[model samples]
Target: MANAERRYSKDHEWVRVEGNEAYIGITEFAQDQLGDIVYVELPEVSSSVEKDEVVCAVESVKTAADIISPVSGTVIAINEELADQPEMINEDPYSAWIMQIELSDPTELGELMNAAEYATYCENEE
Candidate 1:
Protein backbone atom coordinates (compact mmCIF):
# COMPACT_ATOMS: atom_id res chain seq x y z
CA MET A 1 0.00 0.00 0.00
CA ALA A 2 1.03 3.64 -0.52
CA ASN A 3 1.27 6.34 2.15
CA ALA A 4 -2.13 7.29 3.51
CA GLU A 5 -1.99 10.83 2.22
CA ARG A 6 -1.04 9.88 -1.36
CA ARG A 7 -3.61 9.20 -4.03
CA TYR A 8 -3.18 6.20 -6.36
CA SER A 9 -3.94 5.47 -9.98
CA LYS A 10 -5.19 2.20 -11.44
CA ASP A 11 -1.96 2.10 -13.44
CA HIS A 12 0.01 1.96 -10.14
CA GLU A 13 1.28 5.52 -9.93
CA TRP A 14 1.04 7.59 -6.76
CA VAL A 15 0.36 11.31 -6.50
CA ARG A 16 1.27 13.38 -3.50
CA VAL A 17 -0.37 16.76 -3.83
CA GLU A 18 1.03 20.00 -2.45
CA GLY A 19 -0.81 23.17 -3.38
CA ASN A 20 -1.23 23.08 -7.18
CA GLU A 21 1.91 20.99 -7.72
CA ALA A 22 1.98 17.27 -7.14
CA TYR A 23 4.83 14.76 -6.96
CA ILE A 24 4.38 11.61 -8.97
CA GLY A 25 5.99 8.17 -8.67
CA ILE A 26 5.24 4.52 -8.98
CA THR A 27 3.79 2.92 -5.87
CA GLU A 28 5.95 0.63 -3.71
CA PHE A 29 4.03 -2.38 -4.93
CA ALA A 30 4.90 -1.39 -8.47
CA GLN A 31 8.60 -1.01 -7.74
CA ASP A 32 8.66 -4.31 -5.93
CA GLN A 33 7.05 -5.99 -8.88
CA LEU A 34 9.49 -4.37 -11.23
CA GLY A 35 12.56 -5.66 -9.36
CA ASP A 36 15.69 -3.51 -9.71
CA ILE A 37 15.12 -0.29 -11.63
CA VAL A 38 17.85 0.41 -14.17
CA TYR A 39 16.80 3.58 -15.95
CA VAL A 40 13.98 6.08 -16.23
CA GLU A 41 12.93 8.17 -19.20
CA LEU A 42 11.34 11.22 -17.68
CA PRO A 43 9.18 13.67 -19.54
CA GLU A 44 10.81 16.92 -20.57
CA VAL A 45 10.37 19.69 -18.06
CA SER A 46 7.49 21.95 -19.16
CA SER A 47 5.92 19.18 -21.22
CA SER A 48 2.13 19.12 -20.97
CA VAL A 49 0.51 15.79 -20.11
CA GLU A 50 -3.03 14.60 -19.79
CA LYS A 51 -4.42 12.43 -17.04
CA ASP A 52 -3.91 8.72 -17.81
CA GLU A 53 -1.30 9.52 -20.42
CA VAL A 54 2.12 7.92 -20.41
CA VAL A 55 4.36 10.55 -18.90
CA CYS A 56 7.48 8.51 -18.22
CA ALA A 57 9.06 5.13 -18.66
CA VAL A 58 10.78 2.90 -16.12
CA GLU A 59 13.14 0.07 -16.99
CA SER A 60 13.68 -2.75 -14.56
CA VAL A 61 15.45 -6.09 -14.62
CA LYS A 62 12.11 -7.74 -15.19
CA THR A 63 10.52 -5.42 -17.71
CA ALA A 64 10.00 -1.85 -18.83
CA ALA A 65 6.81 -0.11 -17.82
CA ASP A 66 5.11 3.17 -18.62
CA ILE A 67 4.37 5.55 -15.78
CA ILE A 68 1.05 7.21 -16.40
CA SER A 69 0.20 10.68 -15.19
CA PRO A 70 -2.54 10.74 -12.58
CA VAL A 71 -3.51 14.29 -13.30
CA SER A 72 -3.41 16.59 -16.31
CA GLY A 73 -0.53 19.02 -15.92
CA THR A 74 2.73 20.50 -17.10
CA VAL A 75 5.85 18.82 -15.78
CA ILE A 76 7.66 21.47 -13.80
CA ALA A 77 10.46 19.38 -12.34
CA ILE A 78 12.08 15.97 -12.58
CA ASN A 79 14.34 14.06 -10.24
CA GLU A 80 17.73 14.32 -11.90
CA GLU A 81 19.18 12.23 -9.13
CA LEU A 82 17.39 9.19 -10.51
CA ALA A 83 19.62 9.25 -13.60
CA ASP A 84 22.56 8.39 -11.36
CA GLN A 85 20.64 6.18 -8.97
CA PRO A 86 17.61 4.57 -10.53
CA GLU A 87 17.60 1.91 -7.86
CA MET A 88 16.61 4.56 -5.34
CA ILE A 89 13.03 4.01 -6.40
CA ASN A 90 13.28 0.33 -5.43
CA GLU A 91 14.56 1.35 -2.03
CA ASP A 92 12.01 4.13 -1.42
CA PRO A 93 9.40 4.64 -4.07
CA TYR A 94 7.40 7.27 -2.21
CA SER A 95 10.32 9.50 -1.37
CA ALA A 96 11.90 9.00 -4.79
CA TRP A 97 9.33 10.89 -6.78
CA ILE A 98 9.99 10.93 -10.54
CA MET A 99 8.48 14.29 -11.40
CA GLN A 100 6.55 17.29 -10.10
CA ILE A 101 3.64 18.66 -12.08
CA GLU A 102 1.76 21.95 -12.12
CA LEU A 103 -1.83 20.79 -12.38
CA SER A 104 -4.03 21.91 -15.26
CA ASP A 105 -7.13 20.61 -13.48
CA PRO A 106 -6.66 20.06 -9.76
CA THR A 107 -10.11 18.52 -9.65
CA GLU A 108 -8.66 15.44 -11.37
CA LEU A 109 -7.24 14.52 -7.98
CA GLY A 110 -10.76 13.65 -6.89
CA GLU A 111 -10.78 10.83 -9.41
CA LEU A 112 -7.91 9.03 -7.68
CA MET A 113 -8.12 6.38 -5.00
CA ASN A 114 -6.97 6.77 -1.41
CA ALA A 115 -4.50 4.36 0.17
CA ALA A 116 -7.04 1.99 1.63
CA GLU A 117 -9.11 1.97 -1.50
CA TYR A 118 -6.03 1.36 -3.63
CA ALA A 119 -4.90 -1.44 -1.37
CA THR A 120 -8.25 -3.12 -1.82
CA TYR A 121 -8.17 -2.53 -5.53
CA CYS A 122 -4.70 -4.03 -5.83
CA GLU A 123 -5.76 -7.05 -3.85
CA ASN A 124 -8.71 -7.64 -6.13
CA GLU A 125 -6.51 -7.22 -9.17
CA GLU A 126 -4.27 -10.02 -8.07
Candidate 2:
Protein backbone atom coordinates (compact mmCIF):
# COMPACT_ATOMS: atom_id res chain seq x y z
CA MET A 1 0.00 0.00 0.00
CA ALA A 2 2.85 2.39 -0.85
CA ASN A 3 0.44 4.67 -2.59
CA ALA A 4 -2.72 3.74 -0.77
CA GLU A 5 -3.19 7.47 -0.30
CA ARG A 6 -1.58 8.69 -3.54
CA ARG A 7 -3.28 10.24 -6.55
CA TYR A 8 -4.43 8.25 -9.59
CA SER A 9 -5.47 8.95 -13.17
CA LYS A 10 -8.56 7.78 -15.03
CA ASP A 11 -6.24 5.76 -17.27
CA HIS A 12 -5.26 3.75 -14.17
CA GLU A 13 -1.86 5.41 -13.93
CA TRP A 14 -0.72 6.55 -10.53
CA VAL A 15 1.15 9.74 -9.62
CA ARG A 16 3.07 10.33 -6.44
CA VAL A 17 4.87 13.66 -6.42
CA GLU A 18 7.90 13.87 -4.19
CA GLY A 19 9.63 17.26 -4.58
CA ASN A 20 9.88 18.40 -8.20
CA GLU A 21 9.63 14.85 -9.56
CA ALA A 22 6.66 12.54 -9.84
CA TYR A 23 6.92 8.77 -9.81
CA ILE A 24 4.80 7.08 -12.52
CA GLY A 25 3.48 3.55 -12.62
CA ILE A 26 0.41 1.60 -13.71
CA THR A 27 -2.24 0.63 -11.23
CA GLU A 28 -2.77 -2.90 -9.90
CA PHE A 29 -5.98 -3.03 -11.93
CA ALA A 30 -4.01 -2.21 -15.07
CA GLN A 31 -1.35 -4.79 -14.22
CA ASP A 32 -4.02 -7.40 -13.61
CA GLN A 33 -5.65 -6.54 -16.92
CA LEU A 34 -2.35 -6.84 -18.79
CA GLY A 35 -1.43 -10.19 -17.18
CA ASP A 36 2.29 -11.04 -16.89
CA ILE A 37 4.64 -8.31 -18.07
CA VAL A 38 7.31 -9.47 -20.50
CA TYR A 39 8.89 -6.25 -21.73
CA VAL A 40 9.18 -2.53 -20.98
CA GLU A 41 10.21 0.32 -23.26
CA LEU A 42 11.20 3.39 -21.31
CA PRO A 43 11.87 7.00 -22.16
CA GLU A 44 15.45 8.19 -22.24
CA VAL A 45 16.71 10.20 -19.34
CA SER A 46 16.58 13.94 -20.13
CA SER A 47 13.87 13.42 -22.76
CA SER A 48 10.97 15.87 -22.79
CA VAL A 49 7.28 14.92 -22.80
CA GLU A 50 3.81 16.39 -22.55
CA LYS A 51 0.78 15.50 -20.54
CA ASP A 52 -1.23 12.52 -21.77
CA GLU A 53 1.71 11.71 -24.04
CA VAL A 54 3.29 8.30 -24.41
CA VAL A 55 6.43 8.22 -22.29
CA CYS A 56 7.13 4.51 -22.52
CA ALA A 57 5.67 1.17 -23.61
CA VAL A 58 5.01 -2.13 -21.87
CA GLU A 59 4.05 -5.53 -23.23
CA SER A 60 2.39 -8.30 -21.33
CA VAL A 61 0.95 -11.70 -22.11
CA LYS A 62 -2.40 -10.23 -23.03
CA THR A 63 -1.47 -6.88 -24.59
CA ALA A 64 0.80 -3.89 -24.90
CA ALA A 65 0.09 -0.36 -23.66
CA ASP A 66 1.71 3.04 -23.85
CA ILE A 67 2.81 4.48 -20.54
CA ILE A 68 1.13 7.83 -20.80
CA SER A 69 2.45 10.74 -18.79
CA PRO A 70 0.05 12.26 -16.32
CA VAL A 71 1.97 15.54 -16.37
CA SER A 72 4.21 17.30 -18.88
CA GLY A 73 7.92 17.28 -18.01
CA THR A 74 11.42 16.06 -18.72
CA VAL A 75 12.29 12.48 -17.89
CA ILE A 76 15.07 12.35 -15.33
CA ALA A 77 15.15 8.67 -14.50
CA ILE A 78 14.02 5.25 -15.70
CA ASN A 79 14.08 1.85 -14.04
CA GLU A 80 16.65 -0.16 -15.96
CA GLU A 81 16.10 -3.06 -13.60
CA LEU A 82 12.97 -3.97 -15.51
CA ALA A 83 15.05 -4.78 -18.57
CA ASP A 84 16.22 -8.00 -16.93
CA GLN A 85 13.02 -8.84 -15.06
CA PRO A 86 10.00 -7.00 -16.32
CA GLU A 87 7.78 -9.38 -14.40
CA MET A 88 8.60 -7.27 -11.35
CA ILE A 89 5.70 -5.17 -12.50
CA ASN A 90 3.38 -8.11 -11.90
CA GLU A 91 5.04 -8.76 -8.57
CA ASP A 92 4.73 -5.13 -7.40
CA PRO A 93 3.38 -2.64 -9.89
CA TYR A 94 3.75 0.26 -7.49
CA SER A 95 7.41 -0.34 -6.86
CA ALA A 96 8.21 -1.32 -10.42
CA TRP A 97 8.02 2.25 -11.71
CA ILE A 98 8.69 2.85 -15.39
CA MET A 99 9.97 6.40 -15.12
CA GLN A 100 10.24 9.69 -13.23
CA ILE A 101 9.79 13.20 -14.54
CA GLU A 102 10.51 16.72 -13.37
CA LEU A 103 7.00 18.10 -13.84
CA SER A 104 6.02 21.11 -15.89
CA ASP A 105 2.65 21.53 -14.19
CA PRO A 106 2.43 21.04 -10.48
CA THR A 107 -1.28 21.72 -10.57
CA GLU A 108 -1.87 18.53 -12.52
CA LEU A 109 -1.72 16.56 -9.30
CA GLY A 110 -4.54 18.63 -7.87
CA GLU A 111 -6.69 17.31 -10.70
CA LEU A 112 -6.04 13.65 -9.87
CA MET A 113 -7.61 11.49 -7.15
CA ASN A 114 -6.03 10.12 -4.00
CA ALA A 115 -5.80 6.39 -3.32
CA ALA A 116 -9.09 6.19 -1.44
CA GLU A 117 -10.84 8.05 -4.23
CA TYR A 118 -9.04 6.00 -6.87
CA ALA A 119 -10.04 2.78 -5.18
CA THR A 120 -13.66 3.87 -5.20
CA TYR A 121 -13.33 4.97 -8.80
CA CYS A 122 -11.83 1.62 -9.73
CA GLU A 123 -14.66 -0.17 -7.99
CA ASN A 124 -17.28 1.75 -9.97
CA GLU A 125 -15.32 1.10 -13.14
CA GLU A 126 -16.37 -2.53 -12.96
Candidate 3:
Protein backbone atom coordinates (compact mmCIF):
# COMPACT_ATOMS: atom_id res chain seq x y z
CA MET A 1 0.00 0.00 0.00
CA ALA A 2 1.13 3.53 -0.67
CA ASN A 3 1.20 6.24 2.01
CA ALA A 4 -1.86 8.49 1.97
CA GLU A 5 0.15 11.72 2.06
CA ARG A 6 2.54 10.83 -0.72
CA ARG A 7 2.13 10.88 -4.49
CA TYR A 8 3.22 8.00 -6.73
CA SER A 9 4.59 7.53 -10.21
CA LYS A 10 3.71 4.72 -12.62
CA ASP A 11 7.31 3.55 -12.27
CA HIS A 12 6.80 3.04 -8.51
CA GLU A 13 8.63 6.07 -7.13
CA TRP A 14 7.01 8.06 -4.34
CA VAL A 15 7.12 11.75 -3.58
CA ARG A 16 6.34 13.42 -0.30
CA VAL A 17 6.06 17.14 -0.70
CA GLU A 18 6.79 19.69 1.99
CA GLY A 19 6.48 23.32 0.95
CA ASN A 20 8.78 23.80 -2.07
CA GLU A 21 10.70 20.58 -1.60
CA ALA A 22 9.65 17.01 -2.28
CA TYR A 23 11.34 13.93 -0.89
CA ILE A 24 11.84 11.09 -3.39
CA GLY A 25 12.10 7.36 -2.86
CA ILE A 26 11.10 4.02 -4.26
CA THR A 27 7.89 2.49 -2.95
CA GLU A 28 7.80 -0.62 -0.77
CA PHE A 29 6.57 -2.56 -3.77
CA ALA A 30 9.62 -1.50 -5.71
CA GLN A 31 12.07 -2.69 -3.09
CA ASP A 32 10.24 -5.97 -2.67
CA GLN A 33 10.36 -6.62 -6.37
CA LEU A 34 14.03 -5.70 -6.57
CA GLY A 35 15.01 -8.13 -3.80
CA ASP A 36 17.84 -7.13 -1.43
CA ILE A 37 19.22 -3.69 -2.22
CA VAL A 38 23.00 -3.42 -2.38
CA TYR A 39 23.61 0.12 -3.64
CA VAL A 40 22.03 3.45 -4.47
CA GLU A 41 23.50 6.09 -6.80
CA LEU A 42 21.98 9.50 -6.21
CA PRO A 43 22.34 12.81 -7.98
CA GLU A 44 24.50 15.49 -6.40
CA VAL A 45 23.08 18.45 -4.51
CA SER A 46 22.32 21.51 -6.72
CA SER A 47 21.90 19.32 -9.82
CA SER A 48 18.83 20.20 -11.87
CA VAL A 49 16.57 17.49 -13.28
CA GLU A 50 13.35 17.34 -15.23
CA LYS A 51 10.11 15.61 -14.43
CA ASP A 52 10.32 11.84 -15.05
CA GLU A 53 14.08 12.01 -15.56
CA VAL A 54 16.26 9.28 -14.14
CA VAL A 55 17.71 10.99 -11.08
CA CYS A 56 18.90 7.97 -9.18
CA ALA A 57 19.69 4.31 -9.60
CA VAL A 58 19.15 1.50 -7.12
CA GLU A 59 20.82 -1.88 -7.34
CA SER A 60 19.72 -5.07 -5.68
CA VAL A 61 20.82 -8.66 -5.73
CA LYS A 62 18.15 -9.30 -8.34
CA THR A 63 18.54 -6.25 -10.58
CA ALA A 64 19.32 -2.54 -10.84
CA ALA A 65 16.69 0.09 -11.48
CA ASP A 66 16.40 3.75 -12.25
CA ILE A 67 14.46 6.10 -9.98
CA ILE A 68 12.53 8.65 -11.98
CA SER A 69 11.99 12.12 -10.60
CA PRO A 70 8.32 12.93 -10.26
CA VAL A 71 8.82 16.63 -10.75
CA SER A 72 11.32 19.02 -12.28
CA GLY A 73 13.67 20.54 -9.72
CA THR A 74 17.14 21.13 -8.36
CA VAL A 75 18.37 18.42 -6.02
CA ILE A 76 18.68 19.94 -2.57
CA ALA A 77 19.92 16.89 -0.69
CA ILE A 78 20.52 13.16 -0.92
CA ASN A 79 20.47 10.39 1.63
CA GLU A 80 24.18 9.81 1.94
CA GLU A 81 23.35 6.95 4.28
CA LEU A 82 22.28 4.82 1.29
CA ALA A 83 25.83 4.70 0.01
CA ASP A 84 26.69 2.37 2.87
CA GLN A 85 23.27 1.03 3.89
CA PRO A 86 21.09 0.52 0.87
CA GLU A 87 19.13 -2.16 2.70
CA MET A 88 17.53 0.61 4.73
CA ILE A 89 15.09 0.99 1.85
CA ASN A 90 13.98 -2.62 2.20
CA GLU A 91 13.30 -1.95 5.86
CA ASP A 92 11.42 1.29 5.24
CA PRO A 93 11.18 2.74 1.79
CA TYR A 94 9.04 5.72 2.71
CA SER A 95 11.18 6.78 5.64
CA ALA A 96 14.41 6.16 3.72
CA TRP A 97 13.97 8.89 1.17
CA ILE A 98 16.78 8.95 -1.45
CA MET A 99 16.76 12.62 -2.35
CA GLN A 100 15.17 16.00 -1.70
CA ILE A 101 14.17 18.17 -4.65
CA GLU A 102 13.35 21.86 -4.71
CA LEU A 103 10.46 21.82 -7.17
CA SER A 104 10.76 24.01 -10.24
CA ASP A 105 6.97 24.01 -10.54
CA PRO A 106 4.95 22.62 -7.66
CA THR A 107 1.96 22.11 -9.91
CA GLU A 108 3.68 19.06 -11.41
CA LEU A 109 2.49 17.07 -8.40
CA GLY A 110 -1.08 17.30 -9.68
CA GLU A 111 -0.11 14.88 -12.44
CA LEU A 112 0.89 12.14 -10.01
CA MET A 113 -1.29 9.45 -8.45
CA ASN A 114 -2.73 9.54 -4.96
CA ALA A 115 -2.53 6.65 -2.51
CA ALA A 116 -5.79 5.04 -3.55
CA GLU A 117 -5.01 5.45 -7.23
CA TYR A 118 -1.50 4.14 -6.80
CA ALA A 119 -2.72 1.09 -4.91
CA THR A 120 -5.10 0.27 -7.71
CA TYR A 121 -2.38 0.82 -10.27
CA CYS A 122 -0.11 -1.59 -8.42
CA GLU A 123 -2.87 -4.14 -8.36
CA ASN A 124 -3.33 -3.81 -12.08
CA GLU A 125 0.40 -4.04 -12.73
CA GLU A 126 0.51 -7.30 -10.90
Error of 2 at 94 (Å): 1.0
**Residues 36-126 of candidate 3: C-alpha lDDT, one tens digit per residue:** 9999998999999999788779999878899888899999999999999999999999999999999999989999999999999988988
| Residue 24 CA displacement from its true place in model 1, Å | 0.2
TM-score of each: 0.97, 0.93, 0.97
Candidate 1 vs 2: which has more TM-score: 1
Q: Report the lDDT tens digits of candidate 2 across residue range 25-121.
A: 8989988888989999888999999988877889997789988888899999999999999999899998888889999889888888888888888
Query: What is the C-alpha local distance difference test score of each model?
Result: 0.92, 0.87, 0.92
Q: Report the C-alpha displacement of residue 74, candidate 2, in angstroms.
A: 0.5
Worst 10 residues of 1 by lDDT: 1-10
Q: Candidates sorted by TM-score, descending order?
A: 3, 1, 2
Over 4 Å off in model 3, which ranges?
Answer: none
Give one digit per residue, the lDDT tens place, for model 1 in 1-126: 468889999999999999999999999889988999999988899999999888789999879999989999899999999998999999999999999999999999999999999999889977
Candidate 3's error at 40, in angstroms? 0.4
Candidate closest to the true structure, highest TM-score: 3
Stronger candidate by lDDT (1 vs 2): 1
Per model, state how many residue pairs clash. Answer: 0, 0, 0
